[model samples]
Target: MINLFHFVLILTLIVVVISVAKIKDLLSAVILFAVYNLIMSLLWQQMRAPDVAITEAALGAGVTTVLLVAAISKTGRLEK
Candidate 1:
């Protein structure tokens, strides 16, 4: 069986990717990307890999989002 987490993860990934692609607003896209990372981290935990999940939760959901938001703020709100 694929399980609930796997199904949820796949669904979340699809939503995230679609949102990222369709959204014109940079901030919203970045936020969705962060959420995607969090979902992926949970999926990793479901697969029984604590270390990789921790790294993804920290790096992907934490640092990457901060950096991207900072970069976007610095650059400007308007997508250029």
Candidate 2:
């Protein structure tokens, strides 16, 4: 069961990565990248690395998303 969960997590990460790469909109791509981080964090927790998982969830999923959005906002192209 655990192995299956990890497999799914990795698969999700791959799919998100592909989507992020192919997406035309920078903002949407950034959000998809954040989702990728969240999936990896779940995988970390499954591996019993709670500390690392928490960090990834907070920094990768949360902080990175904020930073990306802020950067995009500064560009003014994000409005479209």
TM-score of each: 0.89, 0.85
Model 2 residue runs over 4 Å out of place are 76-80
Put down candidate 2 lDDT per residue, 1-80, tens digits, no spaces.
55776788888889999998888889898889999999989988988899999999999999999998999888864435
Looking at model 2, how many pairs of residues clash?
Answer: 0
lDDT of 1 by residue, 19-48 (tens): 988888999999999999998899889889
Q: Candidate 1's error at 21, in angstroms?
A: 2.0
- Point to the candidate with the largest lDDT: 1
Tell me the lDDT of model 1 at 66. 95
